[model samples]
Target: MNREELKALGLTDEQIDKVMAAHGKVVNSTKDKADKVEGLESQLEDYKTQLADRDTQLDDLSKQVKDNADLTAEIDRLKDENKTATADLQKKLETQAFDFALDKALTGAKVKNSKAIRGLLDMDTIKLDGETLKGLDDQLNGLKESDSYLFEQETEPTKPTIVNPGNPNGGTSTGDDDPFAAKLAKYN
Candidate 1:
């Protein structure tokens, strides 16, 4: 929230400053997570490139093995296994990245319960374009227009803070204040 927005909300300059500081802190925290996610995505892409290179190398090796029947058989078997394994691994990684991004977007959109929101989404329609979700914002906007209660309203004075995974006061906990546990608690 900007200073003007806070001022319009009837807060004094000092109060606005405090709120802005808190908001900035929260935003920076989110940005850090986003950066980490981006790094992971980059790494995943690199793995895909490496896999392609390995496939090329395997093809080269296979050509060299053509003179030896046993070597050719082994190379063919290895090539098939590598293709299947790489395809499965790449699919799994892509799925994970998509899920991670979707959940992050859902959180940033201030959804009250992500599991509930996910049920309303068309998985087929949602596609991940790098860090952006191609169809999610449109769907979220539609949902906000129709099912407003599914999300948290921004008008509230005190925003609910998420505890991160590292800092004791900010991260994981088995207790009530733990963000992960609290999210799980909603379902329980």
Candidate 2:
């Protein structure tokens, strides 16, 4: 209430001064409390934002760790596959080299049906040496000798014969001494 109104209501000046001082103290106290609450609310918001950022960072780190593990597993698998493939390649090369040596040896021995010879020969025991090849050659020669019927036998061509209907022995016919033509000429 206005000081004039309070005075008109028969309030003494000392009582008015006491009431005003009490109201002023209450307003100041409320303002101070509101300011403190506002500061605390601001700090709480900052903490919440920091927590969100930390959670995002943690999620990113977790993903990176999982990806690294997956990558390491993949690398190990690839290394194993590479080792297997390399071993297979080496084995294939060795087999090809052995086959090539066998083929060359057969060719040098002038063996027909080399594939058959290869089938008959023992791959494990066959050595790539001069004596071994000579033995193989001897075996081939023995097979050729025993199986001579396998080779083509060429025969001598027969002489061609000439036949003449006019003469039994290809002699010329004597039309000049024909007795039938002489009779026909007399009739004409």
Candidate 3:
């Protein structure tokens, strides 16, 4: 590998010089190839490091995308539930308003047995329209003409809910409110 080692293998000076020149060509070619390989190995390591970092970034982005999708789905579900709850609450409010209005109307009509009259009145034709009940007035008038006994007489006054569920005429046939009816019941 060195000039001194070649000189020690003693031929003539010219022959030694020629042999050293040929040996230099082969050794320099091999050294150049080894240097190029080392450079390539270092470049390969750099590329590998870059690829690993990009992979990690890609994984994080993918996880974020999945989380966003889950949140969107949850938001959609809550919106649907809210819409259903709002609709149910609106329906309940409308029903209560109608019931209150119907009670007030029956009381104003002087209905003696409210529960009895309510059963006789046709409900299918009734509808609430902005604080007014459609088709209710006509139905009430028809009932007043056909079933006049269900209302308070012109001279006598009576309570609206004068009847009970068990007995449509009144709560008791024993007539607890009248002394004559009570005496008649005792005789019977």
Candidate 4:
């Protein structure tokens, strides 16, 4: 209230001044409290927004972690399969290479049995030179020299011929008039 109003209500000038001073203090204090409350509320809103953003980021990170784990497991399994396949392929190639080299070495060399010869030979001693066999030819030649009977030339047996009664001994006669003795003498 103003000084005139307080005076009309039968207050002295000094009392009116005192009441006005008290009222001004209360208004200022209330305004200060309200301003403080508004500031606090604004800060709370900002905190809530930040918390929501952080929660979203945490969820995204969790999802990414799970995906990474799954991918790692799949990669491990694929690596295992690749290792096994590589080993199998290498073994198959080695067998084919060995067979090819053996065939080349045994081409013209006579052997009683190719399988038996292969068994007698050692694969470790053989060396491959691109498309050719290095040590296998030498090994085969050594085998042929040591075992001549095993690598002998194949020959047909001769058949025995019947002797004629005209000749006492089996000998080549020029004519029937020539004596068998003369044919035998020429040979002797």
Give the Cα lDDT of each candidate. 0.84, 0.60, 0.70, 0.66
lDDT of 4 at 13: 67
User: Candidate 1, which segments miss by more than 4 Å at Cα?
Assistant: 1-17, 104-108, 112-116, 119-149, 156-188
lDDT of 4 by residue, 60-110 (tens): 555566658876676556556656655675675566566655654564475
The candidate, 1 or 3, that scores higher on lDDT is 1
Each prediction's TM-score against the native? 0.53, 0.36, 0.46, 0.43
Q: Name the lDDT value of residue 124 in candidate 3.
A: 83
Task: Assess candidate 3 and give its TM-score to the true structure.
Answer: 0.46
Per-residue CA lDDT of model 3 for 7-53, tens digit only, reads: 66545566667777868866885586567656656755665575566
Q: State in Å the error of residue 8, model 2.
A: 99
lDDT of 1 by residue, 100-152 (tens): 88989998898988999999999999999998899999999999999999998
lDDT of 2 by residue, 1-188 (tens): 66787677566687677667867866785586567656656755665575566556555555566668876676556556656655675565455445556665665554556667666665565554532433455665666688644333445634334454665845465645779878887899
Model 3 CA lDDT for position 12: 53
Candidate 4: which stretches are off by over 4 Å? 1-68, 152-188
Order candidates by lDDT, high to low.
Answer: 1, 3, 4, 2
Best of the two (2, 4) by lDDT:
4
Ranking by TM-score: 1, 3, 4, 2
